[model samples]
Target: MRKIEFVSCHRLPERSFFFRGKQFPFCARCTGIYVGYAIFIPALWFIKIDIYWALLAILPTTIDGLTQAYFNRESNNFLRFTTGILAGYGLAGLSDFIAYWIVHFFKYLFVN
Candidate 1:
């Protein structure tokens, strides 16, 4: 595995959660992100939205992460997972924003 993949081992095991008999690929927060991306990317077309909606989604995760780092506070796996979901929701919005711009750029190039 790459160094990046191995870095998960460095996280606080007290913060890690397990399922069945095996360890998840990542901790709860990362799992939430994965689940969120899976859900939100496809949801863009069904929902009417702008980038700010995504920013709202990201606020919890950012605050959690920053508070943990800056204040040395401890948070639970559930909060991490929920906040990760928020971040993932925003990530999807960011993707949609990028796609919108890309499509318009191509339109500008070919039609103009």
Candidate 2:
């Protein structure tokens, strides 16, 4: 049997969550990101999230990740998870905002 792993994440055991003695497929940060996606994507259709807010949402994760990578700063699972959630939510919102504007522009050009 082939072992499946999430390619995007290192999936370090120390950074991951365990349930029932089995480690979760994704690390804590990734888990939070997916959870954020689950919670935010559905709301996109109803909420009309703004571009500024979306960009703002992503800042924390960017800073956290960068600091960890370049400055040798260490982050805990809780911090990673929280920042991941913000990043995921921001990404989804930003993508939706861009897509909406593109479609609207095309529709306007073709229809009017």
Best by TM-score: 2
Query: All models: lDDT?
Result: 0.83, 0.89
Model 2 weakest lDDT span, ten residues long = 1-10
TM-score of each: 0.85, 0.89
- What overall lDDT, based on C-alpha atoms, would model 2 receive against the true structure? 0.89
Deviation of model 2 at 46, angstroms: 1.8
The TM-score of predicted model 2 comes to 0.89
Candidate 2: tens digits of C-alpha lDDT, residues 9-112: 88899999889998888888888888889889998988877899999998998898899899999899999899889988998899999999999999999999
Global CA lDDT of candidate 1, please?
Answer: 0.83
Off by over 4 Å in 2: 1-6
Each prediction's RMSD over C-alphas, in Å, is 2.8, 1.7
